[model samples]
Target: MERELPKQVFIDGCEQISMEFEPIGFRFAKSGPHASRRAGDWAFKISFQSNYLNVGGEYVELVVHASVYSKAIKEWDERSAWPASASDWVAGGQLGNLRTPHHWRTWNIVNPHTRQAEIANIVANIQTTVLPLFERFDVPRKLAEQVACSQVPGFMFPENAVRFVLWQLGPEAAENCLSYWVARLPSPDAFRSERDVPTLPDRLALGSDTNNLARVARAMKIGLSL
Candidate 1:
């Protein structure tokens, strides 16, 4: 069995490659006493060359639970190999599994021409036909920035999944966007008609089947009752 390496070991190992990282604070289901602050749990972020990822050229944000570091050492016997698999590494989990989480919401883009035109043309259609309408949807202007950044002559995504990856947003960016949505949406009274309705489920992580979502629980705990 491999011995678990401490946090310092992990940080030092990453330092060799110039990977920058810091601990992350987590917000639980937002209910009861745990609602106000995410003081208990911790996360870490690592930045690497965009080409290292399956989705190249775009900056990738890797978020990992602190617990994973210890688990990784035990599993792989190397502090540098913190995430065990490529998929897990990209998806904010262990290194092996790279499955996209369901909580991530998406906007689908459809086009008639498949391969006759270049990717530039396809992206252009996405920008002209889909972007304006997406702007009207509950998603905010800042969140739309990611799609805008990727709209280039040869831009291509690894897959046709609708939503962009949350991890793709730098941790700071993700926090900023999430805070903006929580502050803006939820109360229908804030806006005039349902046309401008803010549906937070589209923005935040998905909730349980009952609609008794972690966000709702946290809201209640924080006294931001809806």
Candidate 2:
């Protein structure tokens, strides 16, 4: 009897999961462990991660991730050379993190006998948790709103968020978004001590003397000053 390669087992598992995902507009890549769907200028993706060591044996541990991307936002950010944090996708996190009262979750596929149940659990999480979240931000404007409010996961900085709003909504929405963050800035006196200075993420989001936020605003032609 020929022993099955672990990679083949993983691919077979993905194929089973693909059947559930395909009807919902997601297309699983050939011989790949991810599926993606396109909606106008945006793309939604679900990717799987597993330990490399498991590839040599029947045991595999998997973590699933869901993410969204915007072609418009990517183009605008690239054209302006804006310093949005590096990420292939615009929004989303691990499937577990996005769940209510969030807790990390992983699947262990120990053998063929147990694989069906594990696959079912993973598919159910995507259907119940991931799909609804993706549906909520189906349009560009809705996604921009979430990004502007910093409610979207994976968009870590307000500067990037506001820029995304600016591109998708307009200068007024961008200005409104910037105003909220600008209002949260600490007074100059508060930064007299090194420890008092806000951290890098905060400073970038809130516009420090380095003026990253202001630079983005100018790049986008928004009139707000830091």
Best model per lDDT: 2
User: Per-candidate TM vs. native?
Assistant: 0.19, 0.69
How many Å off is the CA of 2 in candidate 2?
7.8
Query: Model 2: per-residue lDDT, tens digit, 16-99?
Result: 787898887899875457899998877888887777777544577778888878776677666654556534356677888775
lDDT of 1 by residue, 126-158 (tens): 334332432222332343354333321111221
Q: Which prediction has the highest TM-score against the true structure?
A: 2
**lDDT score, candidate 2, position 7:** 68
